[model samples]
Target: MTTDHRTHARVAVVTGGSRGIGRAVCERLAQNGLAVVVNYARDAAAAKETVATITAAGGRAVSVQADVADENAVTALFDRAEQEFGGVDVVVNAAGRLALSPIADLDLEVLDAVLRTNLRGTFVVAQRAARRLRAGGSFVAFSTSVVATRFPAYGAYVASKGAIESITLILARELRGRDITVNTVAPGPTATDLFLDGKGPEQIEQLAKAPPLERLGTPQDIARVVAFLTSSEGHWINGQILRANGGMV
Candidate 1:
């Protein structure tokens, strides 16, 4: 079981837990003995399926529907966690939107939509997590290695994640004595719908080659890193961006 400062069973609220890497994190944390609050913006079916999988494994979980960008909705999301599992100890802000277009040609509307979900949503969730997570808790945000790679057609998506890295670092300092660790996990070319959606097979192969591991990362791979970051063993690691990219740099 994961260790809480109080040595009680910990609770986690994983935004975007309906599928992909977020779903993997929820499942892994549940296996580690943390009660999970699975948050989904729209995919209620997927969220319910995730909860069912957890419960079937003898893990406690409840699916919650909320747009991470909506303050009132996010507030209710956290309330459900508290009411169902006592209190929250970990929050993994995994909700994000990806749009591919060069900055010059990107529509302003598309930019707004990306920022609304990836940036504003992060802020809303982080604000609530900062206030709710118990001592010795953790808040992990998501970023992309593309922020460093400077990939073309990823302008809006990268901007949102770049802002997230800044928020993660500064918030770790802002929560100084609260004993809550805030960090970002920047993954490289993972094999998830979010990463594979529009890419061609050749492009995927080329990305898979960049990593010394010589393959695309699985959602489970990224989830394991998150599992550590939110656990007592990794609590000392704070205000850092861990790139779980198989040495892709």
Candidate 2:
């Protein structure tokens, strides 16, 4: 769906774009006039639906399936974007896995699965983006506000996102002179399935209140920040972990 009509608009490849924050980011980027490549791991139906919604609104979009941890797959993801659109200007690695468990009783297998997706997947996508993104492009990865809050039972999840934050700056510095921006969006208590799953109303209420804004961050809230980061206006802001948690930190 490279029919963006607007020649000045850029292109974006978003992993996990089928659902949740990724989906929201795709729509927002489209509204900002960027042609979107919606990448999904397994949910082809959802991915197609996302593409349909965007295209229905006169936005250019296409769906592609790729496991974020697979280097070749992500490489092909970028290839698909370039094949559809002219070039890639923005890459958002919103695909992540979260498992909350106290370290004392941590399951090694669970840890491995979480890290495999959240860590290795991020790196694979970033590696491809590093190679494929055009000059002045930006990459935004996902992290968690819990990295600062240090909540219990979040050891595994926080550890993975923590590693993401650590690598983001190095990647940014490494991309010097390329004019690419690499940053992480560390959201806090976002109102998405990933955050709400397995949590009760009471827990949800507590988290909502934890933020000074007194509400769980909507997918759109975080989406807008990502939209800005990928835009030319945000090019000056590079190599930073933006806590889009509504003051949860």
Candidate 3:
């Protein structure tokens, strides 16, 4: 494995790191020489595969499982990072759930589930990162560009993500003088399983064509943006919502 030659190896804890955008983030950060802690909710196998991929690529990584909505589990996640990697410098809260239905027909239980994972999860993870991240650290949360699209049948999901965008600025301000940055990435339609699920071929084609780029976003596309925001070069960008869409607004 290629070792980071820096005075100290930077460590990152990435939620939902077992798959999709989270997996891409883990890989990118590892490539950047950060020791990564890959957090998955239920898929231990996928998590293991993620770690294996990194290790095979000569990067350092480990997998930990936690439901982002659970306070104790999240606390333990951070504790594990400190125990294993010395300290945490980057936290990416990418664990989330999506439930689509018109507001009138949406099941309250489904709405609750979506909020619990997406909104509550973001808050829980953010709180822990705010408390534990070292100076010069960063907390990157995931928000959806659908909040701007206002597409039908996305009321609950949009509502949850909207909450994330609303609190991002406040949280950044709350960490004043900490030398830490907090930002949310609001991505347009990306071709992850999460986005592709329930979408028919026709609908997917329509979305791919809607963006000026005339294509769907890959997970790596989003990860590059996340990596930049958490890197030293992006230190000055704070308390902002970066829309990583290809002119899909």
Candidate 1 C-alpha lDDT tens digits along 95-128: 9899998889999999999999999999999999
The ten-residue window of minimal lDDT in model 3 covers 1-10
Show model 2 residue runs off by greater than 4 Å: 1-8
Tell how far residue 41 is off in model 2, in angstroms: 0.6
Q: Candidate 1: TM-score? A: 0.98
Per-residue C-alpha lDDT of model 3 across residues 1-249, encoded as one tens digit per residue:
333344678999999999999999999999988999999999999999999999999988999999999999999999999999999999999999998898999999999999999999999999999999998899999999899989999999999999999999999999999999999999999999999999999999999998899999999999999999988888899999988989888
Reference-based lDDT, residue 29, model 2: 93
**Per-structure clash totals for the candidates:** 0, 0, 0
**Candidate 3: clashing pairs of residues:** none
lDDT value for model 3: 0.94
lDDT measured at residue 131 in model 3 versus the true structure, 0 to 100:
98
- What would the per-residue lDDT of candidate 2 be over residues 14-52, giving only the tens digit for each residue? 999999999999999998888899999999999999999
Tell me which residue pairs clash in candidate 2.
Answer: none
Error in Å for residue 215 of model 3: 0.4
